[model samples]
Target: MLDPILKRIASSPVLIYILRCCIGFLIGYKLYITYPDFELFWTLLSIILVISPEEKDTRRLSIERFKSNFIGSAVAMVMLLFLEPNVYTIIAGIFVTIIVCRLFNVLNMARVALVALLIIMVQPHQTGFVEAPIYRFGSVAVGCIIGLLIVVLTSIIFRPLKRKFGIPY
Candidate 1:
């Protein structure tokens, strides 16, 4: 009976998704403990973006995510260092992120980039408005790494299961 249940989980995508989610949540929990002030919002967002119930190209998503984070962080940092924090700067970040995505033909990254821009713009002043972009950039970069790691781990665990189920590896 236990073997039958294990085979069902191995045969399905649900188990992989669940495992991936656990990894993300564990990161979030660890961060929260280490830094009491750590807002879990971005971590949760990362989990949602990284783990999918459906099959996806994790590599493509990871690349887009990293690029988008870099673009948003760089734009936000430049704008804050040279100019005053204002709505216009946020708008400019959005436009720039969109343009870059178009240039790279990775339009799907626009949304994630835009979110990064918003995060930078609205960051708490106590932490110094200047630090927002840097923090946001790091957060998303970690997310991308976690996403890739999940993909690799899932593939490794599932390959043997595929054989056990008499499915092509």
Candidate 2:
């Protein structure tokens, strides 16, 4: 009876997706609490943004989003280093991120890039204005890494379940 119930849950893609998200959240939360200096909201947000229900999408999107994140971080850091961290700086970061995304052919992923720019730029200047961008870039990078690792681990765990249950992609 329990085996049948377990099979039912395992066979449903929606349930599997929910489980994957729950796992990501748990990991993200742990990281959020574990490190004091890390701007872990980006980490949590990235996991949600990067993880996909489809394995292929998870692999593809993660790389693209990482590139987007990199662009955003680079733009924010450059702008903050030279200019004040104000509304004008954020506006410039957005435009810069968009342009960079287009040049890199990742314009479709500009939303995530914009988010990265905002997070890095808008976060409270706890460590000071100049250091904020550097710290946030590290946070975003960690987020991308965690999201990719979660995708790989989930794929490994789910493959056997998919095979056993005859689940379609």
Candidate 3:
């Protein structure tokens, strides 16, 4: 039993995932310090949460996420600038984000965009509308970039380890 367990641990996808998650956490902590906004935490969390164990198109995913984040942030900022912060505006912003995501055919990033909209529209942030979206967008964009970089860099570093350990990464 011990031998099998050890083999599985040494040859499974666990090490790569562990490395990616640690990288995410480190980046998140750094961003939290750099950006005074509390929303920065969640932006990083979202990126980390999306880190896949299976190999995929990280560049395409990052592009989709950034585009979706921008759409949501821009729409919410426009609404906040021109209108009052109320249920109608929030709902309108949500609807608009969904529509825009569909139009762009970026359904993969719709949820991310909606989250950006919520970050901008939901709370009466002390930073106000413009600043709030900007911060949210900044943190999210950074997280996405860093997360993809981690995946790429870690993949390179882990390839040899995977080979030696017979890991199925």
Candidate 4:
């Protein structure tokens, strides 16, 4: 009985998403309450786990994520130096960033571009171009690392996942 229930829970994507969201929200809320400055980092990490591809696909996603972020942030910094940023400017930058990322043929590069655009436009003073890009990149790196660690730790401790799934160790 417990085995069938566990299998069903593992197999259901919707259930998994719901669970992840709940957990993410709780963790995000706690982080926000404890350290508001770091809330976004934790929240974004949670979201990353929800959107992350399978373990086998993580390598490609991680590579694309890193490359796109670095390039997009650089482009955003150059743009910021040239133009005065406003809502319209930020939106336009996002469009341009997306186009460029798509040209590069990197998966989810648009998301990285959006992140870069937001960092430049929304929090320029708090984190200048010189430092913001590094901070943004660091946030992503930390989040992905934590997410991967969680996956591995859960798999090891629970030991419920079947070997037949062909997931990389």
List candidate 2 segments past 4 Å from native.
Answer: 1-10, 53-56
On TM-score, the stronger of 1 and 3 is 1
lDDT tens digits, residue span 55-85, model 3: 4554456567767776777787778778888
Question: In what order do the candidates fall by TM-score, top score first?
Answer: 2, 1, 3, 4
If both were scored by TM-score, which would come out higher, candidate 1 or candidate 4?
A: 1
Q: What would the per-residue lDDT of candidate 4 be over residues 46-154, giving only the tens digit for each residue?
A: 3354333454444455456655655556566656667776777777777777778888886465676567557545664545555554555455444444444444444
Error of 2 at 41 (Å): 2.8
Backbone clash count for every predicted candidate, in the order shown: 0, 0, 0, 0
Which stretches in model 4 have alpha-carbon errors above 4 Å?
Answer: 38-78, 81-83, 87-92, 107-112, 119-169
Q: Please give, for residues 47-86, the per-residue lDDT of candidate 2 as tens digits.
A: 7766667644666776788789878877988888889888
Poorest stretch of ten by lDDT in candidate 3: 49-58
TM-score of 3: 0.70
Among the numbered candidates, top lDDT falls to 2
Clashes of 2: 0
- Which one wins by lDDT: 1 or 2? 2
Arrange candidates, best lDDT first: 2, 3, 1, 4
TM for every model, in the order presented, reads: 0.77, 0.84, 0.70, 0.54
Position 81, candidate 3: lDDT: 74
